[model samples]
Target: MHWQRILVGGTKGAGKAIADRFLRGGGTVIITARSAPEEETESHFVRADVSTSEGTTKVIPEMLDLFKGVDIIVHNVGGSSAPSGGFITVTDERWQQAINENLFPAVRLDRGLLPSTIERGSGVIIHVSSIQRTLPLYHSTLAYAAVKAALTNYSKALSNEVSPKEVRVVTVSPGFRETAAATRMFER
Candidate 1:
């Protein structure tokens, strides 16, 4: 594989699956989340909420020290925490939280780590957006969808800027999945 070092921003759901695939391919995988996974894994686990500046600050240094730089970075940490009502129910704080969770981490991480990838002149950054960005359930995920739309746009802009430097930026927007977080969202 061209990618020897990989960083996955979340390790509980889709992110875990991505990390597992890379690990099975013999790549060194580093996975980060707010909490540890329920089961042990081969990938290096970094417990940090990348949604917060402090969390990103903690994880970036560790990642740089461990791999010097990574070959691939999967921005996979995102979710909707707003209540199940429409726009009126979502206050400013909730909207901001949604943006913080669904968008800022990737922006921050890319800002912190892209220099290394650009210096190498070869790397890939994948932003895991959501299908909801285009077809959204406004009652439950309005803020999430909005931020994901922003994420996809940011990914495209980042790609245009970095592709010339040989650092590829791509966005993947997947449909619904059966995960603990999804289950909770359903229950809400």
Candidate 2:
């Protein structure tokens, strides 16, 4: 059982870490982000914005073309776009963007790709959610939290639906990581 194939959908941060781990484990990984990197690498990186339907449509075909199919999908992309002040500073546009970036990608990807994996009767999906979803500090991330809550609920229901079919759906929630971006936010 050589599980040497995985798909990591996210840019930078924890997502990159997950992909790197797969690579180090001798697995072939395919990654996607809003923009392609300047240089090429072993992993197939595609420029995709799963926040939009069009973006999803574009990426799915390219993904199939590259990996044929993946046994694991680790969704580690998500963040808050609302200002740090609180809910007041969060505009409607920002709210939507938060949901788009944090929730839509996973939903769309599962919709587009999970069927085949289900048909084959084996697959694993790991959704990376933030601890903010369950614990919040009353900042602009309220919308993000709500979206993630929805994601968790959706994941539960979806998992139940696919479990009998041999598809496994799991969620990974991370606390405040000491990353550069997080450090900057703390500095502010």
Candidate 3:
């Protein structure tokens, strides 16, 4: 609960809220995104798209150097950028993008940071999945839902492997919330 070091994988929406909460609780918070947040904040900002390998590379070393490791790592980056009209409408590129955004970031971050956590013998990894994983809206979120399901599975497997080492991996599947991204999705 009283984490001394925290890394949030995104700096907007739920990710931003999580980082802010930790910062208010006096934790040293580090947040990453493809772009900086529109407003200023106290958390250490790392501008990197963690969905990609390059982005994870850019973030991991900096965080390891600065904090040695984090006590809590929240994988809070995910979304669907594909168009509407169900499975046939979603292109291969869009599916890959969905996997990159929804599944791979958490995998990469855990791969990068979990070693330190295991070494220290304690840490928590939180994956932000989605309710769409179970109740998929085929019209637009097919790829998103499928990838989130994969994320949930991955989180469970990771938890089994790491729990013995004193690391906790958790998956939180939240329903829709009216964030800026969700608002845009609805408007479209």
For model 1, how does the per-residue alpha-carbon lDDT over 11-100 read when each residue is reduced to its tens digit? 677877887788888867788888886787888888898889999998889878877878789888889878998888999999999988
Clash counts per candidate, in order, are 0, 0, 0
Candidate 1 runs further than 4 Å off: none
Native-to-model Cα distance after best TM-score fit, residue 76 in candidate 3, in Å: 0.5
lDDT of 2 by residue, 1-188 (tens): 54635454534666666766777777667778786644555777778777887888887887667666667787776666567788788788988897888788888888878876776679898888778778975664677788888788888888998989898999877888876557655554
Candidate 3, poorest ten consecutive residues by summed lDDT: 1-10
RMSD of each: 1.4, 2.0, 1.4
Candidate 1: Cα lDDT at 151: 97
TM accuracy, model 3: 0.95
Model 1 TM-score is 0.95
Candidate 3 ranges with C-alpha deviation above 4 Å: none
lDDT of 3 at 67: 81
Candidate 2 regions with alpha-carbon error over 4 angstroms = 4-6, 37-40
Cα error, candidate 1, residue 24 (Å): 0.3
- Candidate 2 lDDT score relative to the true structure: 0.75
Predicted candidate 3 versus true structure: per-residue lDDT over 74-145, tens digit per residue: 888888878888889989999999999988988888899899989887988989899998999899889999
Greater lDDT among 2 and 3 belongs to 3
